[model samples]
Target: MIKKECCYYQSSTVKDDPEDEESIIKGMTPNPLLKKNEWGWAIDPIGFRIALKEIYARYKMPIFVTENGIGVREELNENKTVEDDYRIDYLRAHIEQMKLAMEEGVDVIGYLTWGCTDILSSQGEMKKRYGFMFVNRDESDLRDLKRYKKKSFEWFKNVISTNGKQL
Candidate 1:
């Protein structure tokens, strides 16, 4: 009889050495020096790249980014649209890092955003919205249930049309 064990590592942040002061001064500083979401998660693009490198080195397999997006408190404007430039910026930075990883010989297969349409969060919080399309609803009140394209919608459309070249 043979026994095998498999371990899966999933994290947004990956460090080579946590206690090495020299390594920390070289590049790692324990945490990302970037913006945070409503849930206090660091929006660290550099960390994403580092994680990609680490995973590829370990598994030597193509990586697929299943869920990556920012959750924010969103509201529609008078024109019935959300100017979610922040989301666009977040996606752009992460995509740029992915490209860097690919350039560095990481076999990145696919990249998928968290949500295309506003949906209930994993914690069941409606206020923490993550989507290019805004759904007309609230935590307690289900509004018209209409969907409105946010500013990032068209931007992402362009990104797709160009196959990320425009981004």
Candidate 2:
């Protein structure tokens, strides 16, 4: 539910909450004080891109999409493979939009997505996962932290191998 409710690349309709985020940055609010993990509202990349264009036009510096992705659960099958199509879809959409943004004259440097492997959870639920590499070990079972490439692994490999040209 948290993942579904979170919108990392929402359009202009999203109400800007930079002021609310200021309190978090200023330590007036407890860590993760905001609703769910939406605490990083000030770090909205879509909003940042719009701001960057103004800076780029004035100073001509390279812009960057520093973060973006969908978080989800990953449990390995007996065969040791992970299916992470959501992450792939998330990146693919953002990349397409980025291409359009660059074509429209934004000097973007690169996109750096978060989390390459499964991580421990905040809510202690074993299902809340986000990674291309799946770790067999969950919050409950410290089983040998086995790893598996997710479905996006091949797709991302092809895109990166082609310098994002194939994408």
Candidate 3:
């Protein structure tokens, strides 16, 4: 129904209203109040690893890394290519960390990223994209829809097929 445009764009460890301008601002971008390398966007990798470890230790259970995708306003090319290398880098980093965690004896399950196709932002900004398949739709206009799978999509599919060996 109403996915991103409805109320989303939140990637917080602790859930918050995505529609809230203040909350989105605080969560999406770096928190000004926070020190340069204190929290949030300061160093997402360390923070995410610590969080996963803590949570795994507490539950001591099998965990599926169910949602981990990068959001970016993709640019399409004449060949209908949507280059989202930032997203690829984002996922590669997380997958590497996840593999490390599994090596540490964490019963880590599969990791599912946030989006597979572009959608309008909860705050009404299609510009805020998070998907391998680019959907040409913005907040103000739905526009003629087009789904162009990106290199990351192919890269991800290969990674999955090779069972993390492709990375």
Candidate 4:
């Protein structure tokens, strides 16, 4: 049960509100404490646990977290490495939620991140990246396409090696 954005940016091309309701509902509101991303919205990592509890209560099945990450605008340093502490922070928060859900008896089988390497997004934006590894290519410019490991790579490796205990 992977969770990302609850609300997304509405395209200017679209004429009407997709939900046909105001962005802000009376009782239903987004969390204010979560960190905001480049897209001008916050992601509730705690919601992951809440959602997991609800889903586990309704459907008793082994859950898998697929496609979980943040799309941040970043760049490689002159040393050809990316110090993506933001990605690490995002992942750590969500993983902490998963741990809490597991403590509450949710059967989470596996967790998978969105992308291991930089890839073209559906909107054709390379700047909006969600990857532990950075590919040396842009939207219009395909450079060497060399894969460079980001700071999150080592952190993720440690997390996996510790069976998420370190996280």
Q: Which number leads on lDDT?
A: 1
Error of 3 at 14 (Å): 16
Model 4 Cα lDDT, one tens digit per residue, 1-167: 54433322211222234453424444333344456687754676776677777777777777777778888887789988999988898889889988999999999889888888887777988978889899888878888888999999999999999999997
Report the alpha-carbon TM-score of model 3 versus the true structure. Answer: 0.72
Give one digit per residue, the lDDT tens place, for model 1 in 15-104: 676666633344444345456676666678877888888878877777888788888999999999999888999899989998999999
TM-score to true structure, per model: 0.82, 0.63, 0.72, 0.81
Q: Count residue pairs with overlapping backbones in model 4.
A: 0
Please name the candidate that would achieve the greatest TM-score relative to the true structure: 1
lDDT digits (tens) for residues 1-167 of candidate 3: 32111112123433354555545454344444432321133425444565667667876666766667656656688978876676787778777877777777777766787777876656767777778888866777667887888888899899889999877
**Candidate 1 wrong stretches, greater than 4 Å:** 1-32
Residue by residue across 26-75, what tens digits does model 2's lDDT show?
A: 33433342222232332233444455455567666576655566556567
Report the alpha-carbon TM-score of model 1 versus the true structure: 0.82
lDDT of 1 at 85: 86
What shift in Å separates residue 2 of candidate 2 from its native position after superposition?
Answer: 35
What lDDT is reached at residue 36 by model 2?
26
Model 2, position 109, has a per-residue lDDT of 75
Q: Which segments of model 3 are wrong by more than 4 Å?
A: 1-43
